[model samples]
Target: MTLGNFSRVTEFILLGLSDTRELQILFFAFFFLAYAMVLLGNLLIIVTVKADPKLSSPMHFLLCNLSFIDICCTSVTSPRMLVDLLSQRKTIAFEDCIAQLFFLHFVGATEMFLLTVMAYDRYTAICKPLRYTVIMSRQVCWVLVFACWAGGFLHSIVQTLLTIQLPFCGPNAIDNYFCDVPPVIRLACMDVHVTEWLMVSNSGLISLVCFLVLVTSYTFILVTVRVRFTEGHWKALSTCASHLMVVTLFFIPCIFIYLRPFSSFSSDKHICVIYTVFCPVMNPLIYTLRNNEVKASMWKLWQRYVEGRKRTVTFPGDTDHCILPAINSLLQYTSVIISTMKDKMHKVNTSTVSEFILIGLSDAPEVRFFLFVLFLIIYLVTMASNITVFVAISTDTRLHNPMYFFLGNLSLLDILCPTITVPKMLEVLLSENNVISFSGCILQLFFLVDVVGTEILLLTVMAYDRYVAICQPLQYVNIVSMKLCARLAIGTWVVGFFNSLLHTSLIFTLFFCASNEVEKYYCDIAPVLALSCLPTYSRELVILTVAGVLGSSAFVVTLVSYVYILLAILCMNSAESRHKAFSTCSSHLTVVCLFYGTTICTYVRPSSAYSPDQDRIVSMLYGILTPLLNPIIYSLRNKEVKCALGRVISQVRTTLTK
Candidate 1:
């Protein structure tokens, strides 16, 4: 069977769900927006996972993989289909058809089985608590993830092989769009009964097993939750509940569509939409919304956005206030808690952040003195608090581990990240003529670049730190020694500083110093890059090259590290040890979720969709809120930190008692 003997057809027509003109327009607009959302959403997952240290787990590793999958899987057909819907052409070539079918099924099935494997991971951690480490050893996790990919590969290869062998010499028009096996096989001139059965056996059978395993995994997981009910089992149940909801939503429709032969199904088109388009659309929402942890992180992120608006009172100049329905609709589908989503909103002037207008009761000149006095107290507290933290970490002999080292670096970054933007922003707000010079803008650009880039690099390094500590606990001391910690921390700053140099330098090269208005609340690259009056090719290449290179590498490293961590966690024996291992890593997982969710959301597009308004919103998380949350989460949620704090408090109380 010579492959090119396969006729090199130009293109084949896609018989999409609707041929009606109005419906076509409607679908085109709808899917176009959805495609954007899909890109934005998946990108968000990657960034958040990469940036926030909390999400450093095997599950998040798989999640980041799935996000990449969703983007890749949906990209295969959606954009083209949307484009075709708007154009006269609606055809796919035979080879392209085969490619589409393979990618769709391979990524789709890989995601399905990956979900099952994740559930089993949850079950083993919960139910077989004692032997979890040994059971889910690093080797086992690789085997599991490999099995998933291998299984998807084999399944897709078999299906594609079976389909290609059939005679499709007639009726190139495919119904309900795309190169699906059922519809593609239906076009076969020869009898596809045998191939159909094979499809049923492989596709249907795999779905069945995955469904069963998910069910069984949840069942045992339920029992484990019951045993731990007295311990406020809400967290465990919430995790299980979220996974079940997403899995059921993902597999139920899939099972229904492919379970039987391609017979009379009145809703095939709708089912296909649910499985293909909606599944990817809903996944991020399901994961983010249902889990309280994700919801909390997102809420924290949203708060930053709200604060950004308050500080930048001029608001974004180019914001499309229209179609707020998209986010509203998203809220309907997601579990992000709305009430806690925003408060204490503050605005900053992005255009001239050289010196901020001081907050005073200047509306009434008599009260100006009182206002200044009130704010002076807060300013002092803010500086003192930050200085105290910096000093404590720098001086404390005991606070010298990789963990504390990272924490100190973060505090130092946070102390500086806000200082560069905030005070200047305040000064501009106070005086009528408060404005910044070119040198000031350039300085601001440098620090802003360093702050964001360093944070991203630091978050990735922290994930690696967590991976070493949790996965290689026995060797953690040797592996992540003080010298190593110093080196990693220094490496994070070095990479970030250099990356920022490329980004800031490229933007400055093209952006004329004459265009004084910076159309953003903070000195972010996307909006600044947008400000360039010159050709954007070089600027884009540099900005994206640096951000993309750093972002991609961070994501890959985080994902790979989690895979090993999952393997290590799974290998533990004895429930107590397993619980402790996972527990120790939980904070890191949470932070990773926050970091990846925000950063990926901000950067992972083609650089064309970087809206100043949306960029500011996403940047808030990727830069500000996430870094802030890092210390809060690690300090509040981590027992070690809590113990350390308690020890400090106890000493103070003892002195008071004396």
Candidate 2:
């Protein structure tokens, strides 16, 4: 029962799909394309689903969730596998495998549950059309989503609990691509036959249940469709067909692998390719190509984009809607798309961040000096941007208001966000071998959690700000005053800090640091927490509680705020003023909708249906795009800001002419 009784294995040898060099190269090429597909497809789905009103139903909601799941599920295996294939070494540490096992199952099980719910939803809609609205109302739908997630957590807890308890003091090589129950259980030195049988019911049975539910539901629905078949009814089938096809592909592969006895499948590597890599790649493509609504929406968006581009490229001599400003934003959009998951919401420094090496000579004079200079610049910029924004709002009389106050807090968070990441980054870069002390990595984990938590909290507050401004315009001053803003801002940071602290602390609690090299450049709490050598129910419990509280609370508050805002907007009488109000709110609404909607698509649901890369891009909307757009949006359309800019430009032009 105790980890103390078992000998501690430091690292693990990962037997990637094949040991052959030719196979490795071929696989790398194949997986690289798959990873790209996962990224592009998911982003396209998120953007298209968001842009279209017709695709804004609970059905598209499930699809968006699927896109996100496919993204993470692919990232879990493919990118790492691709890197491993290229390198001479193909090994994953014992600790890393455990982490992978947890997430792999967590996301996988979550998706299974989500698919079952989607099937049920379709069955209810098609089979019981009269009662569909009452049964699948917005509240009921969200509840079902909540229940799906709850089921995922409960299932994942059982599997992780079983796996982590096994004493793995034997052969370190994992036979297949990544960690799974069969491969991992095979590595255990202790008798796992009982656990294996339990898994038959656990992994195999759970999947079978979901599959049967899907099969039965689809059969009845298809029969229902046949009964009501008409010439015009063909189009209706397309929407559900895409989902059904993708679901079949996803579930069949899953059932083939999981539902069967572990020995029944010769290699999980080939199976891994199907579920983790191919399913995700296929999902976005299948959904987008098959769904007419998404295609129409994407077409409109493309037309707008191309026409906008044409206005710039074709008309060099003419100033169309201030072409210079559009030109200026060109680089900004490009940079945002390329940035990392953490840097998703903010404008990141464009300089290449080299991998940190921790060779002994890193302590030498030249190395230390270079590191100080390198990290100092990064640290200085990170601190300055956040501090300046914070001070601009906090101290300046002009900015002594709720809007600026929230912005100041965000800046402060941005400051902390990079602080958590870049310190160890510089430390590793300075060190010749890129080693981080256990204490230091844990420290970085703390910073990562706290800063991210702060940002999420701040965004929720910002949503409230918009609600007040648009909905309760007259009493905006009274409601979101200086004091209230300060309290909310403070509370937000405090909640995030404490939450992050719990997870970071858990990493050090059961953990004896085995691997210093993190797959990610910066330390993240989830990945770090994943490295635990002990039973993971405790860690997952903390994750469930924290993620549930933060993710749900933020989403609910923001969603409720918009509902009120919509109600108030509808009640207003002034047509011109209404148009003006809608215009002003449109940009903010668009940004907010993109932020929380994408987040909920992944996090608010259980881990099942969210994609890692989709999570990356969607999160990036807040992380990279929002920060860049915040300054742009606040400055561009505001008459005061535009006037200020015009004044500065006119003064420069006048002086030049003179």
lDDT of 2 by residue, 543-656 (tens): 545665676567656776776677667878988867776665665566566556644443333222324445544544444444444545554554543454455557668999
Ten residues in a row with the worst lDDT in model 2? 349-358
Using all chains and alpha carbons, the TM-scores for the candidates as numbered come to 0.48, 0.48
Backbone clashes under 3 angstroms, per model: 73, 32
**How many times do residue backbones clash in model 1?**
73
Off by over 4 Å in 2: 1-5, 231-233, 263-265, 310-314, 317-658
lDDT digits (tens) for residues 259-323 of candidate 1: 88864434376677776778787788678755545545665666677789879865333333422
Candidate 1: residue 326 lDDT (0-100): 37
